[model samples]
Target: MTPQSIQKTWWKEAVVYQIYPASFLDSNGDGLGDIPGIISKVPYIKSLGVDAIWLSPIFASPQKDMGYDVADYRSIHAPYGTVADVQTLIDRLHANNIRILMDLVVNHTSDQHAWFKESRSSKSSPKRDWYIWRDPKYDALGNRKEPNNWKSIFGGSAWAFDEGTGQYYLALFLPSQPDLNWESAAMRQATHDDMRFWLDRGVDGFRIDSMNLMSKHPDLPDGKIVNPDEPYQSGAEFFASGPKMHDYIREIRTEVLDHYDVMTVGELGFTKDEQSVSEYVAKDRHELNMLFTGDIVDMDFGPNGKYERDDFHPRKIRTITNLWQNAMPKFDGWNTIYLDNHDSGRSLSRYASDAPEHRATAAKMLATYLMTLSGTPFMLAGQEIGMANLGKDYGADSYIDVEGRNYYNEVLETRGGDVGKMDDVLRELQLKSRDHGRLPMQWDNSPNAGFTVASAKPWMTINKDYTEWNVASQLDDPESIMAYWKQMLSLRKEHSDIFVYGSYTALEESVTGRWF
Candidate 1:
């Protein structure tokens, strides 16, 4: 449908369901979820009454950052079926009147990606400047040091030495996922072209991954050390939402996104202020239609360091609610509010009261609070069933995430070699770790949680509580969190004025227990 023909701003009233492709379902007996597997589950997604399904990256990748490290923007990974399967899945979703928003990991690409491969081959290659490349800073002893004190989000130095050129390259996450230099005109065009390819294929929208990290400082400088208490400080100000980022986003909006009837939501990190949030998604800004903020997600992480623990309780809920309320009046922008995503642990176990007797009430309460808030609400896969974190004993090798495994070993070897302490760290890590959200979807209480037929062990173990939390059991229960979510979504569809375009005013402060 043309943008003009559409009577309402669909995004303003939309409910986006986020599916981590690897764990959602496994078809073709591969023990890994694929396009065909997702296609088979379209009916179940449609039953949730969501406006769109945002599939976390299914694109061809080295799987270093799982699917975030896109190897080929146009094709599906071998493990996740072919491009034809994606097209079929899109067709099926559209047939059910549901839109599909594919993940756009534009901030970076897998180091194995053709562009990165070519970029790394030589300093004079055509794509040499496609990614951030810097000369190593030599120490007093002539030993090569990282260009700056910038640290990777996954711990350790951000710069990786390239033996081919004898220079260092920047990787914000896994060394496998190298940061793209958006300053280059060719890089910008190539990224835009990638989006056009998907838009032309009839996909509806995009969830732009690490969208705010696209632009960086022109003259890379050594940023200030933020924390003396911690080992390394993230030089985010120099890299995140950098100079000319607004221009870059506006260019994409005009050239590619605005030309089509597509909803765009950016994934923003370390951005907690109203002004920065407003500029990205405000109506007149003409950048993204909405974006996910990290204030709520950051609650689980201890302010001191990754190893430290924090009590995440209902009182922390106010911090999230207040930020949204304050932000709503300042911008005509919409929010993509979610408690769980592929990066965080299960919300049921982390935020909600996970005790068996309390699980249902807390799950419903959390859903009610999130769904009623103004903006688009995104429900992570298996969130509707009150899925909790996996067992603490699930070993590091079972984890598909590179960062999780690295941290596991680092803590074990460095910190007194205490296995019990390691267990505590793992428990906390499980609370904040991305792998917890990447487990196989609990479809039924059958072998393999009904996710795959491979008989071979799934990459990550399915949540053991699957027996009671499976979709099959919850679908029939009137008081189930799944059923509550269906009702909440129906309310959103039925009463667009109150739930959609309505101004959000938190009533919890004035009247306790009521969040109107």
Candidate 2:
């Protein structure tokens, strides 16, 4: 590692535990977890030995994309709690010596938001420029067409036409969640104000969501069709890690972030340019502290996309880690290490088998990589307990995720709409569903897995293996996955240099085939 790159910071040393509040704990018996639930579990969070907590989007939203769609940036969602409740949660978390990292979702806002509603009202609305609304293209005979060939991340045209405004607005996720125009000075200032809102209220930092796609090309251009078999080509090149991404990040840092003693980790979907990624996290650059990259996690994508079949390549994990760690300019850029997140599937089930023969050992191996890596480590809520998938039958009744539903329906369409006959489709979800990580956090072996009241319905299904894989049971067993995670966390504090700054050296393949 380069001498100048040996920079030290509290964030660089933190062991971040990501909490999807809705699945963590339910204190009010609302069938959904809330801020108080998190507050009540601060002791539990601290017990895990993590220094900081990163909460997913809790802002006032319609829950269209499970809180990624924000209606009001300043207010807490009613389902979670009130603004006062958030203040108390922050204070209590601080009292426990744990830092709070709020999810900063500036890429898009809910369609119900005042700005979007106003923008949709008329073509000449003052807030019109706040979103990306463009006129349609014309063919030889002037028949109306979409502005560009760009496709949404959620499997549709990126453009959504509004009859009232006579133009199509861009929404990369859902029609209800319209993409915000980062180019607008007013929009950028408003975003800055929102960041200041939480910073003033004592949020330690932010986990910027969809950070790469915030800035898109000005002309709304078409993307190259990489795969002809796929319905919609990925337009990420036009938006993700865009030309102005670094420029905008610098401006945000100078005008907003530099004023506060805070750290930021951008949710940058896998980028090809190592030089570009380093610029975002370099210590000397006025940009993000670290960033979430999915290259290793998404390595299994087959001919099509997420749902396509591809055998898991274990050795590729080391390849990705070595690339990023060495790719950092002078090793000055920091990387965020994690095997699972709200969007990614569970690590125990994804990277390792949950079978009786390999369950605990597999968890240990993954945790070894997660904690021993030379970067900040992050743990998903139920990962420490060795939580497995809920099951394979992701029929409409059991499925709770929006992206999964989109992929499921698309796959079903290709099979004549008879989903019950498609065993392969169901198996794919069993192995790769993001909901595997979103299952209710197993606190105990209660009927509701101690997540909510037995009678109340959880927002999603709970893993049936909670009987064997839960906090209470694991806490008592020294050999349990949870206990192993705690021990590793303690060790991380002792040998912070090796875990936080040491350069990684990939070992050669062993004849015994023990590790990849």
Candidate 3:
């Protein structure tokens, strides 16, 4: 289909690339990546044919969840850079015609944020309702009990007890990360003001983090337990895609997004079989331009979730793509295509072959799948180089990702500290944990993977195979993964008709053994 025949929106035809700032490059040799390092790479980014770069939160943060815990939204994190540096980086990228997408993490805010600080100061404080504060439930023995059965995604009760105010605050992720009460009109206006803050500064777009998690059940009730053995019924059952989500989206759109020409994509945090994703991005809905669905990524997880899973099968992935594609043609909302990101393990290891012999080929195959899809394809940094998962030998001490360490500890505690059981969990993590994608980029064979000075220790450990997989080694090789990615991009640009708008048809195939 020609541009005139199909949807002609810039976002629909554009490709997005996500950059995990801390691991991309360390300019000051502080062992943490900074804005200047990213500024230095603008030319390389432009070369990838990606129209926009989706930057993971670079806001002032405590680094508890690797910048997800924002202490201040308007200011840049000191480790990353000063606010001036961000403006310069934006100018440089814009100068090169590359757009920027900021990660909007409005589901929660760092407890250190001024709003939360005042909210927790006293029950009668002016900002007390900014963050969710519920009276604690007391047990028969007078012990303080949680208000609800909601569990944090980071492996504990979602409600954090605050003895100072004698109330529990809701934090779906971590104690330091408090969930914002969207039910409060004040909070809604505050979030809208924040979006305008960045828009005024000229960001091309925003990938709304935990988008489905904003609206929550008013009374705070216990969700139906899917598995009696687990701690809580996946808090998503009660809050995600809640009753008032569409209202909130439309409100935000009418207030901020509609005024600007920027692209808006929401992250659907939970799984819903219905056409829920379509509702978020349908043009008539006046909400989002597009949304991300993870059902495709979850196809590899077994009955026990990512824990008891063995491997990813291409056939299953194909089925997931077909399901999403065919499910929403009527709703007419676009899809956000991706296989890996800062949260998942490397695609080469999880979805493709990581074996030395077939790494590049499998990488190309996965790229083929991502590129041919009729959606806005997003590529995580380092994927173009066929970066595989970090080695399985890494232990708990080597883990830098907050979520990974927490999950590892959770698995160990559930097994009663059994070393063998811990090994299984660690092994599974090596194959599929979020940490796998957190390793520093392998720019060259040099120490620190050229991510930092030789003496500087990266925030996360460097992959052992950096020498063989670095970008310096693969750039010009015809059979290299980077070359394949470039070729795939070229193919899409050359024939947008087939790759961008062609009706998807999954080819039937069967494989009994491992693919070579």
Top-scoring candidate (lDDT): 2
Could you arrange the candidates by lDDT from highest to lowest? 2, 3, 1
Candidate 3, which segments miss by more than 4 Å at Cα? Answer: 2-5, 226-231, 509-516
lDDT digits (tens) for residues 231-268 of candidate 1: 45687888899988899999998888888999988888
Model-by-model lDDT, in order?
Answer: 0.82, 0.84, 0.84
lDDT agreement of model 3 with the native: 0.84
Worst 10 residues of 3 by lDDT: 507-516
Candidate 2 is scored at a TM of: 0.96
Worst 10 residues of 2 by lDDT: 390-399
Tens-digit lDDT track for model 3 on 1-516?
A: 543435667788888889999989999999988899999999888887788899999999888888889888899999899888988888998898888899999999998898999999999998898888999887799987889888788877898999898999999999999999888899899889988898887888899999999888888898778879876766676788889989998999898888887998887877546467767877677789877777655656667567666566766776778787766555777778898888788778877688998987888888998998888899999989988887766776777677777888887787898867677677767776787777888899998889999998788788989999988998778878898898899899788877777676665554654533
* Preferred candidate (lDDT higher): 2 or 3: 2
Candidate 2 local lDDT, 81-105, one digit each (tens): 9989989988998898889999998
Cα-based RMSD of candidate 2: 2.0
Model 1: pairs clashing at backbone N, Cα or C within 3 Å: none
